[model samples]
Target chain A: MEFSSKLLENAVNEISQLPGIGKRTALRLALHLLRQPKENTHGLSKALNQMVDDLKLCKSCHNISDTELCDICANPMRKTDVICVVEDIRDVMAIENTASHKGLYHVLGGKISPMDGVGPHDLNISSLVEKVKSGSVKELIFALSPTMEGDTTNFYIYKQIKEFEVETSTIARGISVGDELEYADEITLGRSILNRIPFENSLKL
Target chain B: MEFSSKLLENAVNEISQLPGIGKRTALRLALHLLRQPKENTHGLSKALNQMVDDLKLCKSCHNISDTELCDICANPMRKTDVICVVEDIRDVMAIENTASHKGLYHVLGGKISPMDGVGPHDLNISSLVEKVKSGSVKELIFALSPTMEGDTTNFYIYKQIKEFEVETSTIARGISVGDELEYADEITLGRSILNRIPFENSLKL
Candidate 1:
């Protein structure tokens, strides 16, 4: 769209560069900012610049942090011996929200996707190996999504540290807790049956 | 959702304050920024802050501009005697895209909405009336949206300018150019029939 002001065009150009935002949406948002009090725009820009300039990545877990270590990795109460390996920090946040996993997280940053030109070296796998080789971690859980790339990454990491004395496992895969059996995909349904636990085990949760 | 970094949380909070953006979407956008190169985040923040800091409203039409008069108002090619009154600069852009009207514009900034505590004083209506009283304007087109507030605004301005010798008219209200008759709203279809021009006149376009 044609912008009367050069500054407006510049702002819209930058905003639309973001994922999922289009030129039309960027224009609407920029116009909305123009209509509001000056402080709102000032606050938005200041916060964004500050976050990018001062934000830190956890040295241990590879998760976002304000300090050298993320809160999860810094918390002594969490099970440091068990590290849940995942694709990105979003997964870390999702797992954290559930409060189900008390173990530490090792964000892989991204999975090994050859199609996307992302390989094992592109991930945080080496540091994970170092963490495992140090012998502090007793167990390493593969919490990556059940995709081809995820599975490949998991296998690659397992091969790297298989000689170590750490126990390795993947998160369980099956139908959702409240989903109908008929709606379950054939692969998932078959897996659920093959990996069936004792009837008593289902009642534990 | 819990954030590992206070800076991340602050950025999300500020970004979410924009119209239609929620907390989850805000976090997604902020994270997207973080994942990109540092230059991307710097560019976004710099553009946003610069636009808000240096932006100007045209003194004549109140369309956003960098100088005293907007490009259109300052242009000699456009007719200054005929003014198209609109609710905002977005309308100006819409009408400009049509390339149908070559006259200047008078932006009202916003409609008079009592439900939103917006009155005539909140708009640029007085300056518009003053423009008419100056006797330089030959005609004024009411190009506001076809809503209750739009109608109220048009009528209010009409009462203010009736004493002047300026010709006043509302933009045509009818079915859109490509709209099917069956799907056309009752009011629009009825108005299209009532305001039907002569067959030969329609051929002029």
Candidate 2:
């Protein structure tokens, strides 16, 4: 799109650099910004710059945070002994939102996908190993997705810290509460059947 | 969605303020920005702030520009006597991209929408009237959209400039090229039929 203003064109170009936003969408966003009060642009740019500059990674779990230690790891009420290992900060947010877990998290940053050039060393496996080696963590729950990459990362982390004598378990794979068992994939349905828990355990939720 | 960082939360809130972006998408975009190099965030923020701060409205056409007069209005090759009226800068950009018209533009800023509390006084119509009153402009083309508000704007402007003795015309309304007649909307098809041009005129392009 030809822009009469160079500033408009530059803003649109920078905005379209974001994931999933095309030139048309960037133009729409830019025009929307133009129509709003001047303070709106200042607010947006300030927020973005602050987010970038003030952003920090939790030293313990490698999760994105504003401080050295994330809220989950810093909370004494939450059990640091039980570390829920996951792929990224989004997973941390998702699990925290559910309130299903009362433990700290170990964000691996990404899965160990050889196809994507992400190896075990590329993740936070070494620090997680160090945490387990400190003899404080008693359990490491694998909450990564059930994909091959997720399983591989889980196994790799487990192997790295198995000698520390920590209890390790994967999150349950089963037919969701509202899902039909028949519609579930063969492996998931089969696993659900094999790993069936007591009726009272399913009643917790 | 709960965020671990206040900066992240603020950024997400500001980003989702944009049209069509939701909370989840905002978080995704914010996280994506965080994952990139620091320079990327700086570049984006700088571009947005600079765009807002350095922006200017062309004195002649009221289009967004870097100077008093927009490039098209300032161009000596373009016909100064002919003015294509449009609702906003985007419409000007769309027409300019087509390269079909070589006339100067008079951006009205917006249409007359009483329901939305927008009236002729809210737009840049007075400046346009002054341009027509100058008597240097001979042809005032109504290139505004076909919507009710656009037509109202066109009619309002025509009335304002009619005493100036300038010729007025609207952009053609017809079935789009490569569109099926059966699938075309009723009003557009009817107008296309009613305003049928000579066979030789149709063969010009």
Candidate 3:
């Protein structure tokens, strides 16, 4: 697309560099900013710049944070001895929203994807191992997504701390609560059947 | 969704304020930016702020431009006497891509939409009428979208310029070039038949 103004073209180019945003969408967004009050654009720019420049990761969990430790890690009531291992802060937030996991989180930052040149060494795995070796963590739940990389990361971490006394387990794999059985993928369906719990256990929830 | 960082939340809120973007998409975008180099975020913020602070509208046609006159308005090769009226710079860019029209453009900024509290006075209509009254323009082609507001805007401009010696016409309404006849909408199909040009006229294109 041809832009009449150099500044407009620059803005569109920068915006389209974001994931999932195209040139057309960038143009629309740039035009929307142009039509809005100057303060709105300035506010957005300020917020983005500030977030990128000053945002922190929790020293304990490696989750995105405003301070040295994230709120979840800092909360005294949260179960520090039980840490939930996940891919990123988004997963941490998702699990937090459900209020199902009272444990602290250990964000791996990303999965161990050899296809993307990301290895175990590049993740927060070493610190997690250190935490386990310190003998403070009693249980480390693997909460990454059900993918090849997730399984690989989980196995890799499990191997690192297997000698320790910490109990290791993965989150349950099952069909969604409201989904039809026929619509469930074959692997999930098979796993759900294999991992079926007692009827009494199901009622506990 | 809960954010561990205040800056992250602020950035997501600002990004979500853009049209069609929701909270989830905003968070994804923010996280993507965070994962990238600080330079990417800084570049985007700088570009947006610079554009909002420095971008200008063409003095003659009101198209978004870096200078007083837009490229089309400044071009000596283009026909200044035949002006194409459009809704915004997007339409200007769309028509420019076709390379069919050799005339200049008059951007109305937006259409007459009462539902949106927009009217002729809210647009650049008065300046367009003044341009026609100046007598340099011999023909004005209304190229607004075929919507109720577009029709109202076209008629409003036509009424304002009726006293002038200049001629006024709306772009032809018809089925798209590659569309199937059976799938064509009733109004468009009927208008195409009613406004059919001579066989020889069609051959000229």
Candidate 4:
């Protein structure tokens, strides 16, 4: 769309560069910023600049943090021997909210997708293997998604640390608690049947 | 959603302050920005700041501009006496793209919405009236939306300038071009029928 002012055009162009935002949405957002207090824009700009400049990643888990080591890694209460492997910080947050795992997390940054030119080396795999090699980590849980890329990354990481004496397991796949069995996908339903656990085990949760 | 880093949380909060963006979308956008090169964030921040700091509005028409007068008002070839009154610059751009109107525009910024606590005094209506009182304007076309607030705004401006010698009109409302008659809403269909022009007059376009 044609913009009356070059400054407006530039702002919209930069905003639309974000994923899922189009030119129309960018225009709406730019206009919204224009209508708001100048301090609002300043705050947004300052926050964005500060984030890009000062944000750090945990040296141990590769999750985004404000310090060298993330809070989870620095905490003494959480189990350090059992590390949950996931794709990124979003997954880390999701798992943390559930409070189901008492161990630390190893954020791989992203899945190893050959289609996207992301290989094993592109992720945070070597450091995880290093943790296992140190003989401190007793168990590594593969908490990646069920996608092909997720499985590939899981297998690749398992192979790298297989020689080390460490227990490895994957998160269970099953029908959602409230979902109807008829609506479940065939693959998931079949897997749920094959991996069925004792009735008492379900009650433990 | 929980953010591990304060800087990340701040960025997401600021971004979510924009219209229609929620916390999850803001987090996604913040992470996407982090994945991009540092220069991209800098560029977006700089553009937003520059737009808010240096953008100007047209002295004559009140449309957004980079200078004292907007490009439309600055152009000597366009008719100066005919003014199309619109709610904002977006409408001006939309009408301009159609290549249907060659007159300049007077942006009212917004409509009169009592529910939203907006009144005529809150808009650029006074400046528009001042332009009409100057007697140079030969016509004023109301191009605001057909909403109740838009109608109230149009009526308010019309009462302010009815004594002037200028001709006044509103943009026609009808079934949109290429729209099926059966699918058209009752109000629009009824209005289209009531305001139908002669077949030969329609052919003139």
Candidate 5:
């Protein structure tokens, strides 16, 4: 009774399995697709099929690519000495969009999570270590989210590569960003206090 | 800069062409498909292709079906004497879900709209006329929404079939339903008054 046709129901079920989508949204999407022309639907189907067949992880950076190396890894202008490490390919894309950093990237595929049965061996940590051990890389920036799992992954990787001569650092965390002191979270306030910068030229601290 | 990957961009563009889906939503859907297992994406693609290849319009009622005749048209229990004309198959399913109507259906494919270049000939109006001329049907119900185009289509069809010796009627339209009288629009209030039912249970009015 919920859906008009079995095909619609099946499509909705498949769409609902995606991240951030539910049954209602899936149903809406299905109805929308059904209203489109057959040529458009054919194009959508072909595109989906092609993505499944053509997409593969780069051997070097573990980022999604059609070839052995991702675009970032193949780019000559990118700084090879400073490699930014991220949990997923989407994160790599996010940083790439900023256009501020001109460094190369190494996608971790996933972070180490003991509860989820994912460990250091499961991720591309060994490859990262090997990349650092080659003596070409100098600094490794950890651009991970401020979450418990992210912290755990960061500490795990940090411990593994501490013996190496490469410098390790994480993205700065504190009062983000045009935030008033009254609305700032306790952890952010505390971190900002602990890592306060010296006020020299303008206002006296 | 438009899209990171050519394959992903193609997929997002194709999905965005579907009705009611924008570029951002299409990207979300494409990314969702990318994250799914290969077999799941294959199934979705197969389903979409199958729908395009296997689906056909029924010769009898013009509803979508896998066979020459739709399931509803072939059903013996459904009353052939009453035929409900609708804009699309979705409307048929909407009425069928109510479980009140026992009649057949005729999908017009779309309503008449000169602005969109959709005319009387563009829709399955000829097929509907032929079905009416068969003399098996006694009543034709216009179950279209209260849109200007729907009204125009209904009037056109009514003019075509008025000469035929059959009962012709339309689904009631007035103040809908659970609406407070004070908040009713002037047009709806006027229509409600014109079509108001008598309080007395008289055998004949």
Candidate 6:
């Protein structure tokens, strides 16, 4: 349907491109934005522009950052020897919220989803293997999702690091399935982290 | 939860302020924006900034426009003599989508809702009465919702214009009830407009 203006229609189209937002919801969002004060709109626009201009993927961890290395990767206080591997930056946030995992993180960007054309090459799996090869890390924790793609990625990473003396483990997955690690409640994810199992043990079971 | 970066969190917060968006939805939207090309983000940001910078309320009709008068009010093909009075610019768009109405529109901003502290003065009622008094307009069509506040506003405007030579009427209420006009499909709204009744005759009946 035609809207109040072309600009409004454009805004709605942009908003509807977001996951879970339909045309009617997009229109509602557009109208809400239109009713907001000028400063609110300006703040939103400025924030978006700043994200585009200033934000970058951290070279070390692949997490979003303002500088070359993300805060988690650059922090001297965090344990660099214990590396937690996740599918995305959101998982980093999820693990960080518990304040229990003091280890560093490696964001693989995504899992091995051949159906979606995402392969191991598309992820940061090589960097993760290189990190293990450095011999400094004592433990490699797999914090990937419990889904099939997550399992595939975890198995691939484990196989690459099997020769290393570093301990390789996957976070417990009984609590979450068929969902992103970001959506898992903090408590559940924290418990899962605490109850991790060795990759070989999981395969044996 | 601690996120990848402060800027990403800020963007998520701003997006969540839009109608019907929650934390998860906002995060999904933020992730989508992050994945978009630099040009797409720039275009979205520019559109938002331009919406705040360029749009203003039409002084005569109160419809949103980049200029003092909206396109409909400025168009020579539209019948200036028959003004379709609506609660807001959204209603004008709803009517415009029908492609049946050939008249100009007058937007009242909102209906009179005393419980919500919205009074007659809060609306553009005075400008509407003045337009009718100017004697240039031949008809004033009230395309308000079928709610208590809508009925109240319509009656108030009708009473103000009854003394003038202008023909006063209201769009049919067969398809809607109270604030539900925003949800009404286009065909229903169009049919309602076509079946409008004379204000004086409806009062007598």
CAPRI-wise, candidate 4 is high
| Interface RMS deviation of candidate 2 | 0.9
- DockQ, Cα level, model 3: 0.91
List the pairs of residues colliding in candidate 1.
none
Residue B166's lDDT within candidate 1 is: 95
Identify the runs in model 4 with alpha carbons over 4 angstroms from their true place: none
Clash pairs, candidate 5, are none
Report candidate 3's interface RMSD in Å. 0.8
lDDT of candidate 6 over B1-205, digit per residue (tens): 5676888888889877776678777787777788777677778777777776677778789888767777888899999899999998778888998787899999998899989889999889999889889999998888898778888998999888898898877775566456588788887788778987688986884
Q: Write the per-residue lDDT of candidate 5 for residues B1-205, one digit (tens) a residue.
A: 3454778778878877765678877877777777677888888777776665566678888777767888898999999999999998778878988887898999998999999999999998998888778788799999998899999999999988888878988887787667888998898789878987777843463
Local accuracy of candidate 2 as per-residue lDDT tens digits, B1-205: 8899999999999999999999999999998998899889899988998888889999888899999888998899999999999988889989998999999998888899999999999999998899889898889889988999999999998888888878999999999999999999999999999999999998998
lDDT against the true structure, per candidate, is 0.93, 0.91, 0.94, 0.94, 0.81, 0.83
- Candidate 3 residue lDDT tens string, A25-106: 9999999999999999999999999999999989989999899988888899998899999999889988989999998999
Clashes of 4: 0
Q: Which run of 10 residues does model 4 chain A get worst, by summed lDDT? A: A30-39
| Candidates 2 and 5, the one with greater lDDT | 2
Candidate 3's residue-wise lDDT over B19-109, tens digit each?
Answer: 9999999999999999999999999999999999999999999999998898889999999999999999999999999999999999999
lDDT of 2 by residue, A4-114 (tens): 888999999999999999999999899899889888999999999999898999999888889999888888899778999999999999999899999999998899999
Every model's DockQ: 0.81, 0.83, 0.91, 0.89, 0.35, 0.48
lDDT (tens digit, per residue) of candidate 5 on A57-150? 7888888777778788889999989999999867887888888679888888778888999988888898898888888889999998888889
What does candidate 4's lDDT look like per residue over B1-205, in tens digits? 7778999999999999998999999999999999999999999999999999899989989999999999999999899899999998899999999999888999989999999999888899998999999999999999999999999999999999999888999999999889999999999999999999999998998
- Between which residue pairs do clashes occur in model 3? none
Give the runs in model 6 whose Cα sits over 4 Å from its true position: A3-6, A175-205, B115-117, B175-205
Model 1 C-alpha lDDT per residue in residues B83-162, reported as the tens digit of each score: 99999988999999999889999999899999999999999999999999999999999999999999999999999999
TM-score of chain A of each: 0.97, 0.93, 0.97, 0.98, 0.88, 0.81
Q: How far is candidate 4 from the true structure (C-alpha RMSD, Å)?
A: 1.1
DockQ of 4: 0.89
